[model samples]
Target chain A: MKFLVFLEHHGDALEKGGLGALGKAAALGEAVGVVLGEGASALAPGAGAFGASKVFASEDPALAPPLPQPRVDALAALVVQESPDAVLFGASVLSADVAAGLAARLEAGLNWDLTDLEVRDGELVGKRPALGDTVMVDVGWTDAPRLALVRSGALDPVESGGGAEVESFEFETSDFSTLATLVEQTQEESTGPSIEDADVIVAGGRGLGAPDKFTLLEELANALGGAVAATRAVVDAGWYPYATQVGQTGKTVSPKLYIAAGISGAIQHKVGMQGSGTIVAINKDPNAPIFDFCDLGVVGDLHEIVPKLTELVRAQRGS
Target chain B: MKIAVCVKQVPDATVHKKIDPATKRLDRFGEAALNPTDLNAVEEALRIKEAAGGEVVLVSLGPEKAVESLRKALAMGADRAVLVADEGAAGSDLLGTSRALAGALERVEADLVLFGQASSDGDGAVLWAAVADRLRRPLISQAASLEVGDGTITGKRQTEHGYDVISAPLPAVVAVSDAINEPRYPSLKGIMGAKTKPQETISLGDVGVDAGAAGEAGAKTTVLELGPPPSRGDSVKIEDDGSAAQKILDYVVERRLL
Candidate 1:
């Protein structure tokens, strides 16, 4: 089976999720990378290391911004041109829009929030977690040119020590596609590695008592050379930025160490971090659902214990 | 400035959802509530209607029972509601659902279309985009804040790295995030008046969608199997007697995490 993987990039680096999807697609069958935007061709050649045997690039100026419609138009044209068996994306704010729009444009089927994909009996099957991540369901498409959006961080990009042949394609954007304009874009001011890339994550939930209490998690994260994350409740409450949210509607992380402070361990949050190497929970409620799954559960007031733990970690790390 | 808000009735978030063993689909017989974020969209539309001289019409696609959810939204001050209910539309995936919704929106002919970022049940978060594409309109998603001006609307939305401010013309689609605004509770008077409000339920054929092109028949994806998630293994619990920090540190050290 032939697969086309959408590779989203910022400046020069390709998004990890897209690269991971490309890697998996290459492992399964012939994988081609699709790159768009001003510098898309520059990023196309690098797709080889991540397992794409060939890269198709469209450097249309209209596709430079992170808008979805233009990319959808370009991708739709490519689908009609190449007719790949499937189109895959590593889920993101932008890629989700593009994938869904492409699906609508092509009148094709899309399976989203997928955690895994494999070929069984000559058919591509997707594994999706549903019902609050308590159940896993196997999903498949009934027709060709299947579209799928894999969950963020669900796959890791692998280096195959190969090179890809780069090809350029041309496409037209519909008038409606150009109707929306990006006025401005600004990054959140943050220090340390991002949650997705952090080795350790110190996550705070409503149990932190107040928004100001998040400083405790931040300090702990800083001491451990990690990053701080928050539950959807806190983020929705404006206690933290949406970018740091870790849950069903947010980015998924698989850090080496995940410390849940004052979190009740809702399934929404559990699915995002369940892949961590070591899971620890600090909560006052002994009956908190987090205790049922965490590798180590500490029943205590996080306000009291988090500070002490931060000090010990600071002393041990000697930072 | 006529605005149409798309809403959904999702299984209650507090309830432990289960998939039916026979159908491999979520059992919807349990308690249900209007999707939380869709309320945000409704609230935004109401605010826009209050400021501008226009009507707020609700558009939904679900079983007939979903009228309950529409009534709740109507009590929040929407003018009227239209629900495309048909057995042929059941078990519809994102694409199939978007087809029917796009058709309904076209029939509504509102200047502005609104939707929540995603439904808590499927959590696909991309239906608005699909609908927008099907309707051939501009789309903006994850809007944290919105400003309507002459023939145009600007939205501020959060992204993984930062935030973006996007602008699109009228006759476009926008999906608001939970951060957009707090939804208002139905007033006593509004609740009483909601019963008299106009609610029309139609079928897929009414929206010009063929029976074969909707629901399970039009769905391009199929569920092959269902089972429980993998276990996380055993856990060790300890009560804090002023020594919890020390124990946690020891566990971290054993794993060399620090």
Candidate 2:
């Protein structure tokens, strides 16, 4: 089967989720990738190493700043021209729009909230989480060019060291499609890597005693070259920004190493970070629900334990 | 500007959900309430109405029970409410739901349409875009803040790194994020006044949408199987003496991660 994956970028580099989608598509069958925006041409080659055999790029100036309508037009044009059996997307604020618009434009089927995709008996099946992530359901489309939107961080990216044949695609948009204009993009100023790109995450919860005490998690994260995250409880308490919140209602993260300090592992929070490779939870309450799922659980006062841990990591890193 | 806010009646998130074994779908017969995020959309619409001096209309699609959500929106100061309820509208996916809503929205004259980013129950977060596509209007989603002036709508959309400032022409679809504003509680006087507000209940035929083109029959995706999530198994607990942190470091080191 032929598959086309939409690649998302920050106008500088391709995003991990899009690369992950490409990786999955490559595993299934023949895969192609498409990049859109002003700097899209530069990102085409990167997908080749990850799994795509052919990369299509549309670099109109109007496609800059990551707006969706122009991208929908660009992608719809590609779909009509290429007519791939399936189109895959990684969940993001922008790609979701493009995927939805493309689905409506083509009158095609879009199965979203998917965690995995596979082909069985010559039919494509998508797996999705339902009933608040408590269960997994198998979903299939009634027709093709099947559209699937995978959850963020659902797939791990693997590089194949293969080169891609680059091609350029063009799209014509109406005045209504170009009505939305992106004025400026301002990133939140932070010292370390953002949570999405971080391999290691040190997250805090209400057990931290107070908001200012987040410095403890930050110190350890800085020493370990990781990022800091927080539970919805602390974020809702005005202790942290919603961007760093990890839970059902917040952003889902699947880091290489995740350490939960002073967090009680509620199901809402667990659903978000359960995909982490290694989970180490520190809480004074031994019976905390988080202990049921974590790989290693430490029972103690986070205030004393976290500071000591930070010092040790700092000494080990010699920073 | 005349505004239309899309509200949905969803099972309360606080309630434990049950799945129908046969259909593999969530059982909505339990206690249902207005989606919390839609309350924010309603609040945004009311604010836009207060600022631009226009009427706020609420639209919903579901079973007859969905009217409860519309009434709550009316109580919150929406000038009017429209309920599109049909027996065949059950099990409609995001696309079908958007189609039904677009049909209802066409009946009213709206300069702007607003929706919550996502419903707590579905969490798909793509309905507004579909509605916009069906209506062939501009869409701006995940708006953290919004402004209107000179026949245009502008908003700041939150992103992983930061936020993007985007502007679109009027008569666009806007989905507000939870951070936009705090929803207001309906006053007693407002609740009483809402009872007198104009409300109309229409069926799929009334909106010119065929029953076969929506709800379960028109669903683009079908569920093949439903099962509990994979278990993580049991975990190991460690008593934190003074060396607890060292053990963690050793664990990380053992895995060659550090």
Candidate 3:
């Protein structure tokens, strides 16, 4: 089986999720990497270590700003040429657009929210979560060049210690494709590591009491040298930024150690952080479902418990 | 100007959700409500209609019950609604839904189309782009703000990096994010007025989509298995004694996590 994986990158470095897709695809079969952006061609060699046998790069000034239209045009052109059995993508804002556009352009089927992939009887199958992730459904594509969009942070990138050949493609985009212009791009300023990259994460839920109480989580996360995340309840309540939300509807994370404070451990929140190596729940409600799945359960008030925990961790660090 | 908004009926997440052991599908038993984010799309469309002097129409493709969601949109002040109810659409994936919805939009002759960034259930966030692609129209997704004018539709899309201000022509597709605007609740007068509003039902065939190309037969992907995720393993419960924090710290230290 042959697969094509889209490598999302900013400048010369590729996103870790894309590398994960490449790694998965390479494990299944021959995996080719497709990179589209301003300096897309320069990213081919790095794609090799991630298991890409060959890299297809499309570098056009018009494709700058990483908008989806030009990317659709570019990927559509490449897919028509390569005709791989399946196309896979790692989740991101731009990847979502390009994947949808490609599926529409090719008149092919796109299956999304997938967490795993496998080849069965010479056909590709994807695994996705349904019913608030209470069930994991096996999904398969009905057509060739089947498209699959994996959820972000679902796969881990592995190095094969191999090299890949790089190929550059030049294509013409339709005038209509270039209609949308990206005015500007700003990065949200963050203090510590992002949830996606943080090895340790401290997440809070409505149990945090108020937005101001989030400081307790912040202090605890800081003392542990980890990032802070929030449940959908707090994010929906505007107690925290949407970026820090961890749930079925928010970002999926798999930190080595996840500390959920004041979270009820709803299924929605559980699905997002279930992949953590060790889960610690601190909630006053002993009946919170989070305790059922957590590695450690602490029945207590977060406001009282979190500060004490932070002080202890700080003291231990100083020791 | 004419605008069409796509809406979906999803099981409210606040309630208990179940999956059928036999079929391995989300049991459609229980309260079904309009997708919350789609309410933002309806509100955004209504605002555009109020500003641009146009009609807002609602389109949905699902079981007959999905019309309940369309009716809710009508109650929110959409001029009309179209329901594409067919058994053939039962197991359709995002692509099939897009094809069916795009066909319905073509019949409505929509100048602009809108959808929520993603449904709370599927959370795919890729449907509108597929629809826009099928219709050969430009797409602006995850819009935080939107405006329609002089044969062009512009929107601001939120990204992890920041935001992107994007503009497309009048015949474009836009997906609004929850950040776009606060969705308005249906007022008493609007709910009563919605009772008399026009609602039409169309089939997949009526919209030029073949039944064989949708639902289970036409689904690009099929579900092979359904089961709960793995357990998180044995948990070490900690009682809230005065020394609970010290115990946690000790555990953290033992794990070398600090």
Candidate 4:
């Protein structure tokens, strides 16, 4: 069976999530990776190491634009021409955008937020959390080019692998139609670390007592060279910026060490962070759901516990 | 420059919404709301217009009552609004919705366009791409933060392994992440102004989108079934006390839950 993987790009190579997603598509069949930008070949070894047989570069001037239509058309057109058994797109925000458009264009079944995937007995099966982690759904599709947007951070990039050989396949665009016009593009400067990609996240909530308490977390984040994440409550109270929220409606994180202070682990929030390698929860509520999912549970005031822990970690570095 | 923001009214996240056992799908009446994420799009568009100086038009495709969402957008300081209403559009799958949006976009000369990264309900980010494809423009998705320059737009995109800093050309369709900005409420003057604002409430018919291709009938992948996620088996309440820990340990060993 042949499969197509869509790659999202940052510059000349793959966007982290798109690269990871192409890694995912490699699991389905003899992989045919499709790229839309220049220097995409630099990103091919990762896909190849994951099992892609070849790469198809669209080489469109507009491929690198962080826009949806051009990316969608490039992938959709390639999928249509390739007639692969299934297609995979990164679950990142941009990948989600392309998957939605491609899924619609291909009229293929779509399963979102997939965490694990495989090709079993000629069917593509994906596992995703459902009902707040109470249930796990295993969805499968037999149709050709069955489209899926695998969740960002769901699968780890293969750690021990060499770049795969690159043999260019054809990227065709004859059947594609461009509907939207590009008027202008602008990119914003980042202030804090992107929440979804932070390694060590220090998240605060209403339990922080008052807005001022976030100061310590900020200091800790600065010391650790990390980002400060917030609960919806903090943002609602105007104590923190909404951009720093970490939850279902917010950013989902898979950091190595996630420290939740003063925040009651709402189920939605838990779903977003439960995947962290080691979760440390500090809430006065001993029965908080967050504790149930944590590697270490500290039943105490965050204002008191966090400062001490922050000092401990920082002092460990002797900085 | 005129910009269009594709918006949606969704169940508020905080609201307790449960799908009815009978229909096994979204219970809209469960808790009505304007999708919080879309508000980011509305806010971003208004901010752009405020900064760069342009008109912002909000568009939505849903039930007639969805005019409330458009009105809310107006209250949020949108310069204009459009509601593509038709029962036929109710169940429009992603493609149908995209086709509908594409038809409307063709008629509207928007210099820039935006959408919520994904609607909280459908949680699908299609409109930006479909519209972009139909319009033949570059599309940027998941714009966590956006800055517009004299001739280019740049921002960081969340990716699988890390964030990507990307640049795109003008007239791009962007899906704004909720992190972009908080939405503003309609000011007293803005409320009064919205009343005077020219909002052309067009139906699906006006857009020339084939009703057959706009909703359930037009949808490609139909939901044959919708149900709650499979439930986890009963949990053995593991007592954590040192004495009870033995039982928990025994249970863990017996089950190999580790």
- lDDT (Cα) of model 3: 0.84
> True-contact fraction for model 4?
0.14
Looking at model 2, the pairs that clash are: none
**Residue-level lDDT for B252 in candidate 3:** 75
Model 4 chain A: weakest 10-residue lDDT segment is: A174-183
**Candidate 1 residue lDDT tens string, B68-176:** 9889999999999999999899888887799999999999999999998678887588899999999999999989999999999999977888899999999999998
What lDDT tens digits, residue by residue, belong to model 4 across residues A165-234?
A: 5655454442333333344443434445556556667888888888998998887666556778889778
> What is each candidate's DockQ, to 2 decimals?
0.75, 0.67, 0.64, 0.14
Give the C-alpha miss distance for residue A243 in model 4, angstroms. Answer: 9.6
Lowest summed lDDT over 10 consecutive residues: which window, candidate 3 chain B? Answer: B19-28
**Residue B237 miss distance in model 4 (angstroms):** 12
Query: By DockQ, is 1 or 3 better?
Result: 1
* B37-116: candidate 3 lDDT, tens digit per residue: 89999999999989988999999887787777677889989999999999888878777788899999999999989998
Quote the true-contact fraction of every model.
0.86, 0.71, 0.74, 0.14
- The DockQ-derived docking category for candidate 1 is medium
TM-score of 2: 0.95
TM-score of each: 0.95, 0.95, 0.92, 0.73
Q: Model 4, range B133-225, lDDT digits (tens) per residue? A: 656665666667888878666665553334455666667777777667777888888776667776776877888887677665765443333
Best candidate per lDDT, number? 1
Q: What DockQ score does model 2 reach against the true complex? A: 0.67
